[model samples]
Target: MNMMVPPPSHSSLYYCFQILLALVLFSLQMLTHQLEASSSKVEVLPGFEGPLPFQLETGYVGLGETDDDMQVFYYFIKSENDPKKDPLMLWLTGGPGCSSFSGLVFQIGPVEFEIKEYNGSVPSLVLRPQSWTKLCSIIFVDLPLGTGFSYAKNLTAHRSDWKLVHHTHQFLRKWLIDHPEFLSNEFYFGADSYSGIPVPAIVQEISNGNEEGLQPSINLQGYLLGNPITTRREKNDQIPYAHGMGLISDELYKSLQKNCKEEYIDVDSRNELCLRDLEYFDECLSGINHFYILDSYCESDSPLWRRSLTHELKKSSSSHLTDTVPELSCRIYSSYLGRKWINNERVRKALHIREGTIGKWVRCYKTDFEYEISDSVEFHANLSKKGYRSLIYSGDHDILVPFMSTQAWIRALNYSIVDDWRLWFANGQVGGYTRTYSNRMTFATVKGSGHMAPEYTPEQCFSMFTKWISNLPL
Candidate 1:
């Protein structure tokens, strides 16, 4: 054997080369994974004239098992002021089914629809001067499932608030894992409307996860809510709110208080007097736009509002009866423009949306989306005890979720008032009133604004937001 081992065999050399090649390929693959973890790039949106004037990245974060088709879609806009150092807000719009794009264009995002004309083509985009992106990086997400560009492999994956909270918690963890660079940035959970019900729960989950030593911790510092629905009892405040605004006579309001016992929601079936008062109350508000009593009621044909018909039946029917009231339907035209713009084939490609994934894009989805957990008032109380910073604002003119109701809940929190109610100045005038609580919670109202504060009072909202987030008085 020692005499002539045939020196070395070509077969052995070939085997060694194969092993080396495999190792090299595996190493390259690992490098690729790392690169993809932070794979955000500048976007070139279709409706916009040139390349996106600001940095925007669109991506999907998978939920549940890899094989499970639950995925959440998101639009991340890097902070124009300082992406690296600025806070990161996870902004969830109301409607529970409203697309994140609604927030993007209508509320806080950098661009808005330039509704100059509607020729059955995609609507042009224009820069929003008061975009929240100027102060903090924003992650606008289509939550739950079946919203915006987000879709689940199975329709059954559509979730209610209970499951939605867990999924959203998982989404935040996974998103941070992929974009680790933002893990250290100050984080806040911002939501409005019905999203108010889930944002607190989601924050609580994140807090619990961090406590359990979860991977990729979130640097959650606080949260933001505007015109939020904090409890099911929110409807109970309508009569009082109506009376305060002088929409109803004192006698009618007193009759309601005596008959309804301040419980408009879930009225006792046996209370005939209460029912009669409610009937009269309904008649009085029939023609008023609950969203903004000052603004004319605008009828919308969008599927979102159509689905919401049941919820708005009382208001709609009332509005219909009052033919004398003025009609200003600008919001309807805006909704039509957005729907057309998003559903375009070219626009889909520009946004990197997968074809056949979503059916139609509406500003807000219908109630077909289930919600298992309804109330999150306790979650808010728990979060308040944790010493987290909070900012809750409402549109003073909004009758939908009246500012008075919001004030009621804040008072219920039992936190001692740190700063007594006072006018918050913006643009050298009184923008709204604000009160600070001992637990770092601040409640402010945007004067002359509606349910969607940012949309109605962008400049004042921006000023208040910038000041509050900067730890300055609003």
Candidate 2:
């Protein structure tokens, strides 16, 4: 059958032009950068007292032919149990812009900021008893440029979700090329939150590279996502989540469902009923903390804080540092302290952070980021069909990425249940629930935890990771 094709509209032509230009610019960036994969061993940091017990290395993997073109910074922590045999993970922190430092110091990392009153000095560091470093060597990266210690000579290079995955995959190859000693170790790609969009895609990139006979073949075993953003529909799932959690009344919930059709994120301006119902929904959720329901919502955790807080505001938040976390979510306070600690000149020098690289490091920044991928279910399906082991978990208390949504996507995979849903334990108590699927994928929930499960329920998350990584049924 022959069909007449419509001429490309002006908007479509412009979009195509934009994509072509981006490709040219990106190729130029590749040629211009002076790629250097450098590493430095650190014995001590400013906050932590005395010599560090675990081995920590900080380095930069250049992404271009010239300096400042793009330098991706990273912190490598060798496995405490057995670096030689333990799984090696290239962990990306979510935010699409958040530093992997969150994964290191806040979530699964060895040392955490001692959450207490900040005496205006460098915040103290305390060792986490359930650090994931015990089971695996982790590479915590400042990915996608302009994130943490990473920087780009041109800010334009810092745009796009596609670019983020591309650069990260490149960084991994360069890193493994430099550290070939760990190439034979079981490798995993892990991340949380917004990384759901990129981590799976990164896995696909790796698989493609390996198939193409790339050097230093990564012993790719599997991957993990903690409270991941699997699909955009999850945001829409929040309305049902709210209603079920008793945040909204049945009458209002019914009204929303009837009028808005559960499309809350983008209600039509012309649809008066839908708009009114959405406003009611907003009113119900206005003061509530979306990250974790249990956490007390503070001024810093407010929407205004997200919109207005600049570099200075982020670096100097001592008001919340008074009297053992009064008026502050412990998570936000710890994050504030982390910002303070990392910005310290001495701390940067100790970690061997490149001078003149970053001006201020925000814990999470989405302003410069460009979102292209709306759903990662395709990547998940593709990876699962290849028999890649996966651990997809959610924090039960997190409304940001609810457990229901995680389960929804997992169910969409159409993999048969290998292990029916059951409780997983830690410390002789229920930690979370778990279920295994036909494709070697396991899904679990961290009870009473938030968006970043490990940040709140470290012990349970650790237990989950240890068991799953060791091939034990959890």
Candidate 3:
């Protein structure tokens, strides 16, 4: 692993980024007063990585402070052919502590897991081809430090939402400057889960920059989200919809009713029955050990567990791994073990889980949930006002940040339509579909999928993105 260290804390990337955001926020204030500034996207030379023939570069981006020299890891991947033919896609993984690089290893990249060995020992997911890399050159990053190979000096230095957005801006800005040839390429912001929150923030911040005529303008094409946690206020709000929509079974409904009045739900809301069911679902997933309960149907043995995701995972028995292992299962199970599981030579030598993983993961979740509900609203509205593409997608079976939560959040956006909303097949499958509202916002769903939409249904996930960016029907 390449280690990039910053100087002792006199002047740091973190401080500089904050200064930049303060300046941008102040500029927005002036824009409210009708003040004018100049904005344009930067141009950069296309990157290349020799023998492979595609433009690719792996390096550290300077951030935080000039004197202290804080930095983040990012890989720029692009097509070798005409830049205009493919759009620039930024991919981020959740865990706020997790590295964008992990996405490269697990999902949308040239490599994917082959799963050569699967004994009782935890299966080490390996490298295989991700269908998305075939459509677009994807960039993966490690933000807020301690994720994958990303390094940070201390815990306190890595936990701020404001800091995350600031560093992200500088990271992209530097990327554009370093590779000026792809100036005309369209840029799309995207991520999954907790990142669902940060993606909007970064996109909105960029759009805000455009409105104020400050900084360079990015094409800011649109956004692509997979089973994202888009709304906090709507957290428990989706239960009724979940029940009414038949997402949960009648048996599960009764279980919820009996338990909530006695064991789980708060029941103060309007949809008491629905909320009860949703609370049962939440209680069913409160701990990592109970994770298998969420998708027990993926296996081929446990009858009760097998019934949970019956509609989603079509296996008749339990004990069999789901068609595709969930990234959530992989993460939570690993996180539960902490450094104890990292002692293996392959793991220790391959990545730095023992050193920075814990801090990054812990801080990532802390900052995301620590804010007021209104903060999310401001972030979403600001994103739409700036012409940035904002997307909230859900997997029907994803209990973590369920589709119900996303639906409520979309209703909250209320972005005025530039074009009438359109609905159509997303992957040519009856179960998958897309709906575009106001020409700038999109809400879509992947059928029979859980938290990691792409892992469960790569073809559908790829189809959704290709159509979204190219403005074509699947």
Q: Write the per-residue lDDT of candidate 2 for residues 14-86, one digit (tens) a residue.
A: 9999999999999876654424666789999998889999999998898876755788899999999999999
The number of clashing residue pairs in model 1 is 1
Tell me the whole-model lDDT of each prediction, alpha carbons only.
0.79, 0.82, 0.54
Please name the candidate that would achieve the greatest lDDT relative to the true structure. 2
lDDT of 1 by residue, 101-160 (tens): 878998899998886667666788889999999999999988867777777777455567
Q: Per-residue CA lDDT of candidate 3, range 1-474, in tens?
A: 999996758567778888999999998776532211112221221111123434446655555444123556666566434556678877888655565654664456654433333334433433334356666767787776555444555635665666677668767766666566655778888788667767778777776665677555666777777766554433343344445555566788666656454323235467566565655665543342221223543222222221223212223212222233334334333322222223344443233223333332321222232222223556777666655665566776665456766766676777554444344454455545556677377777777766667766666776676666676643
What is the overall TM-score of model 2 with all chains considered together?
0.87
RMSD of each: 5.7, 14.2, 13.1
Q: In model 2, what lDDT does residue 202 have?
A: 91
lDDT of 1 at 65: 50
Candidate 3 residue runs with Cα over 4 Å from true position:
1-55, 118-130, 213-216, 237-294, 297-375, 415-428
Estimate the TM-score for candidate 1. Answer: 0.87
Ranked by lDDT, the better of candidates 2 and 3 is: 2
All candidates' TM-scores?
A: 0.87, 0.87, 0.65
lDDT of 2: 0.82
Task: Point out the higher-scoring one by TM-score: 1 or 3.
Answer: 1
| Residue pairs whose backbone atoms clash in candidate 1 | 286-318
Pairwise lDDT winner, candidates 1 and 2: 2
